[model samples]
Target: MLDPDRIRVVAPHFKRRLSGVTSTVVQLIPAQRRRGLGIATLGPGLPETMPALSFAQLPALWKKPKGAAHRVWHARRNVEMLAGIVLRDLLRMPLKLLFTSAAQRHHSRYTRWLISKMDAVVATSARSGSFLKVPHTVILHGIDTDLFHPPEGVDDTIAGTSLPGEHLIGCFGRVRHQKGTDLFVKAMIELLPRYPSWTAIVSGRVTAEHKGFADGLKADIARAGLSERIVFLGEVDDIKPWYRRLTLYVAPSRNEGFGLTPLEAMASETAVVASDAGAYREQIAEGMTGAVVAAGEYEPLRDAIEAYLADPGRAHLHAKAAVAHVRADFALAGEAAALEGVYSRLLGVPATSPQS
Candidate 1:
C-alpha cells in the first residue's frame, strides 16, 4: 500500500517500453530521494526500489499535504502529459503540471499541444531548446559517476564477457543505422587491419527491426577477414567494466537528444571520440578530454581513432582529464538538485538544499 498523501511530486511514465526517458527516470528518482524530496513514480517498467503511486492513489492529490500548497505532476512523454492534463483539468485534481522535453527535432502538432498545457518546461540541452515552441530551462543530462568510475588498474579483459583485446574501442547504444553503428564499423574496418594491436567492440541491443542491419555489419567485418578483430558482445548487465576496459569510446550517432555515453565513458576515465550529435560537442572539451567529429563522417572518426591508437600516451592523459571533467561538471546529484529547484518553485515551496 502506498501513502499517496505523502507524495509531493509525481513523475508519471505511462510508456510500457524502456527507453532513454525511462532510463532517466530510473537514475533520477533515487538521486531525488537522496535530497529528501517526497516524489514517486506512477507507471510500469520502473525498478521496484523507486516509490510508485497507483490509480487508486490518484484521488489523494485532492487532499493536499499538510502545510504545502499543491502536488506536482512531472511528465516526460506526450501521453504522460495528457494524463497530467486530464487529472488536473477534467478530473479536477489539485496538481501543478510540469514537462521535460528532450527531443532535438521539431515535435508533432499533438506533442506541441500537450506541451502548451505544461505550467513549465525543461529542455535536456540548449540544442534541444531550439526546437521547442515554448521557452524552456536547459538542464543537461548527467551520469552516475560512482557507478561508472575508473578501474583501480587497467585490465585487458572485459569483466562480464570473454571478449579479449589489447585495447578496445567501443561504440555503445542501440545497434542501428540511425545510431551510425555502420560508420563505426566502417572506420574500424579501414583502420583495424593497420593497427593490429587495437580491436573494436560494439556493445548494444539490436532490436527486431534492426537485426538485419546489425547482421550486415558483421558480414562486412567477416568479408574484410577482420571478424576476430571486431567483436559484437550484444547486451550486458554490467557496462561499467566495459567502459573501464576501453582505451577509447566512440559515439557515432547521426542524431541524438542528449547523448550520455561520452559522459559515461569519461566518468570511467576513458578517452572518447564522438560524433557531433546532440550534446556531444558541448559535453567533450576538444583536445583536453576527447575529440568530437562531424556526424555521419567516417574519415574524421577513423583519423581520431588512429591518432589515439598511435599515441596512446596522449589518450591516457585525456582519459585522466575526462575523469576530472565528469566528476566536476556532470555529477548526477547536480542534475537532481537542479530539477528539485524546478519542482519546488512550481509547488511554492522553498528550494531543497543543493547536493554535492
Candidate 2:
C-alpha cells in the first residue's frame, strides 16, 4: 500500500471488468512508481500488490501532498471523471482533475461537459486528438518491452495443447465483427492450404452477443477443412507467451481506440499486418516494420498477410526491425516519464528525471 499522505496523484479504475483502459492502468502504474512519482490507484479489479487506496481513504484527499499544492485525479473513463468531479467539486478536495481520451469519435454533449471540467486532457493518438474541442496533449500508448520481447530460442509448440505447423500467424482481440475476425479467417482459409507449413491462430474472447458470429466463422472453417490449420484458443491468462510464439501478428480491427496489440507483437519480435484503424498506421513503418491496409477491406488485408507468409525470411527481417523500432520509440519508461511531466504541470511542481 502507498502511504495516503505521500500520494500526489490518484488513478482510478471504476470498471471491474478487464478492458483496454484497465490494462493500461495495470501496466502504467508500476512504471510511474518506478519514476518516483507519488501515484496510487483506487478501486477494484487491479492487482492487490499495486499501490492502492481504499474508498474509505478518500477523505485523505482533503489535504495536499508533501510537495505538490494539489493532488492530481487522473481519469480515463467517464465514470472516473465523474468521481473526480464529485471529490473536487462536491467534497471540496484539493485535486486537479485530468482526463485521457482514446476514443476516435466525437464526444457526446455530456462527455464534452465533463471534459470541460478537467484541468488537463491527454489524447492517446493524433486521430483521437482531432475529435477533442479542447486543447490536449498527444501521448501515444507504449508497451512494456521487457514483458513482450523476443523469445530466447525458436519454439513453435504451445505447451499443454497440440498446435502444429513450423510457423504461426496470429490475430488476437475480441472475436467480433468490429475486430474483423472473419476477415482473418477468410484470409487463412485461402492461404493456409497453399502454405502447408504455416498455421493461423485466433486468440480472444467470444462474448455472448458474438457467439453466433463466432459459430458462423467456425462453420466456414469446418466446411473448408481448415479446422486443424486455423484454430481458436479463446482467451488466455498470459498473452505475452502467445506473442513470442507468433511469426507474424495481425490486428484487423475495423475500428479501434489506439490499438496496442501491434506494439505488443512488435516488442515480441514479430512483424505485423494491421488495418488502418486506431494508431496502427502511425506505429507501423509500411514496408519496413509491417504493412497497413484499408480498414475492413478484404483483398488488401489478404494480400498483405500473403506477402508475409510467402517469404518467411522477409518476415524474419521485418520482425528484427520491429523489435528495434518499439525499443527505440515505444518503451513503457518513455510513457511513464511523459505522463509524469503532465502530472507535474498540473500539480505546480517541477518535473524530475525518472530514475534509471
Candidate 3:
C-alpha cells in the first residue's frame, strides 16, 4: 500500500461498459483525438487507454418487494465483487468522491450523503464542493493536450462575415438548460451591434430542455439581423481548428461541476471569457488567463469580449499565457501523478522500483 491510510473509492454507475467503451471510439477516442479544453490532464488514461470494465449481465426483474429486495441484495453483493476485482484497492482506495452534471440539484446532496459513509471526499469543481460540508480536496480536471491542441494552422474562411472591426468569438458544449446558452445568446445579440463585424459561434447538441432555449437564440440572432454574424455549428468531431480561429472562448454555464468545456478551450489555447462559476475560481486567473464575469452576467461577458476584440495582441497574449498555465499547472502527466499519489497513499504501501 502506498499511503496505508483508510480509504475507499466508489465508482458511480454512469453508463454500461459497452456504451462506455463505445464512448471513447465515437469521439475524442485517444490522446491524439482529445478535445474540449482540458484533455488527459484530468485522469489516469487517455480516451483510448481508459479502463473498461465488463458489465454485469442484467438479471430478470421481479415484481414484488421481495423481488426488489432480492435485486438490492445482489447489487450489494455485486459491489463487493467489484471491490474484490479492485483487490486491495477496495481497502486502500481513497474515499475520493466526485459527482457529475450541474442542473441535477439532488446529485450533490445525494453524493454527499453517500460519501458520508467514507473517510474523505474530492470535488471536481467548486459548485459541487460548495454543496458539501465534508472535508475534501479539489483536484481540478485536466485535459489531453496532445489531442485538443490548436490546429497546425488556422484559416478563417468565416472572417469575411465579421464586422469591419469586431473579432470572432465562439462557445461550445452540450446544449443543456443550466449551461446558460440563453444568457450567452442574449449577450451576443446585445453585443453584436457594438462590434458590427464581430460574430459568435455556438456549437454542440442542445438537450431537450435547452432545445427551446436554443431556438430562442436562433430567433434572437435573426431579430438582431446578425444571421450571417452568428452561426451554430452544432456538434463537430474536431474543434481544434475552431480554437485557432477564435479570439476568445466563452462558457456561460449557470452551473458547472468542473466546466470541462473551459478546460478544453484552454487546452486548445483559447483564453476563456466565461461565467464566474465556482469551477472558474480554480482555473482562470482573472485578467491573466481570461475574464471571469459574474456568473451568467451577459454584460460583463460582452464587455470582456469587446475589450479583447479591441486588442487582438492582448487577446493573443492571454491565449498563449492560458495555454502555458494549463501546461504548467494542469498537464496530463501532473494530473496522473497526483492521482497516483492519492491512490498510492490509499494503497498504504510503498511502490517499489522495477529492479528492486
Better of 1 and 2 by TM-score: 2
Candidate 2 global TM-score:
0.97
Error of 2 at 351 (Å): 2.0
lDDT of 1 by residue, 154-272 (tens): 35345434554567789999999889999999989998878877888989988999999999999999999988889998988877788988889999999987878899999998999
The CA lDDT at 70 in model 3 is 14
Better of 2 and 3 by lDDT: 2
| Tens digit per residue, CA lDDT, model 3, 201-221 | 888876666778788789878
- lDDT of candidate 2 over 40-75, digit per residue (tens): 999999888878999888887898889878999999
| TM-scores of all candidate predictions against the true structure | 0.95, 0.97, 0.70
Clashing pairs in 2: none
Determine which window of 10 residues in candidate 3 has minimal summed lDDT. Answer: 67-76
lDDT-best of 1 and 2: 2
Error of 1 at 46 (Å): 1.4
Candidate 3 segments whose C-alpha is farther than 4 A from its true place: 1-13, 16-50, 56-109, 125-130, 155-166, 351-356
Candidate 1: C-alpha lDDT:
0.87
Residue 312 CA error for candidate 1 (Å)? 1.4
